[model samples]
Target: MARVTVEDCLEHVENRFELVMLSTKRARQLATGGKEPLVQWENDKPTVVALREIAEGLMSYEFIAEQEIVQDEPLFAAFEDESNEAV
Candidate 1:
């Protein structure tokens, strides 16, 4: 149970430029001591709403991994396989 600080959230938002404006506004509010959910538009759609969920430490790899649809197992395995190709 780790804590996802405001800084961590900002970093994600910065990397995810698709929601730049939304993340910026949320980040600014956080800097000013606000702790509400951060909503943002990604590609002109309401997709990256997990900004706050990630900030609250609720967006764990385990949680997401479960929800992910493994449609391309071979493709994923090829990328995940660590052998001579990695070296």
Candidate 2:
């Protein structure tokens, strides 16, 4: 599709909220260079490519749900050095 609309992606995902979350997650993955786009490269940004992937049935709720959400900065980072020392 020329433009990747939410309606197009809705077929794969049930609700608009989940669709947004899934697309956002996919976009993050793309931005981080963690995964390659399942669709062709049209020089589009990460967000656009993510939406296109969803519209083309390459991305789905299951795919997003299975991925482990890793935090960039750990919540308890301050204790890391102490925890690593011999005890």
Candidate 3:
């Protein structure tokens, strides 16, 4: 019923882009039913619930950012190996 605005979440998440990424990732997790919902029923969409979670400081942004960085490392390494082979 309540609106979740970017400004409401900005204090918790310094970067707007990072906020968007983290929220979307959380939304995907919710969509896949991988994680339990932190908030009660509001008849909201997954993305809305995710944004609310972030705005309310229910999720850890640092943890999500670190996970994303770690997940990308292997892909980058594989790409580097392929480039080396081409060269």
Query: Considering every candidate listed, which one attains the maximal TM-score?
Result: 2
Q: Is candidate 2 or candidate 3 better by TM-score?
A: 2
Candidate closer to the true structure by lDDT (higher is better), 2 or 3 = 2
Please name the candidate that would achieve the greatest lDDT relative to the true structure. Answer: 2
lDDT of 1 by residue, 1-87 (tens): 243355766654444453455544444434453443333323332223345556655544455445445685676676667765878
lDDT of each: 0.47, 0.84, 0.79
> How close to the true structure is residue 83 of candidate 1, measured as C-alpha lDDT?
65
> Which runs of model 2 end up more than 4 angstroms from their true locations?
65-87
lDDT of 3: 0.79
What TM-scores do the predictions have? 0.32, 0.70, 0.67
Per-candidate clashes, comma-separated: 0, 0, 0
Better of 1 and 3 by lDDT: 3
Across 1-87, the per-residue lDDT of candidate 2 in tens digits comes to 498898999887888998889889899988894887899879899999999999889897677656656678788876886788856
TM-score, cand. 2 vs. native: 0.70
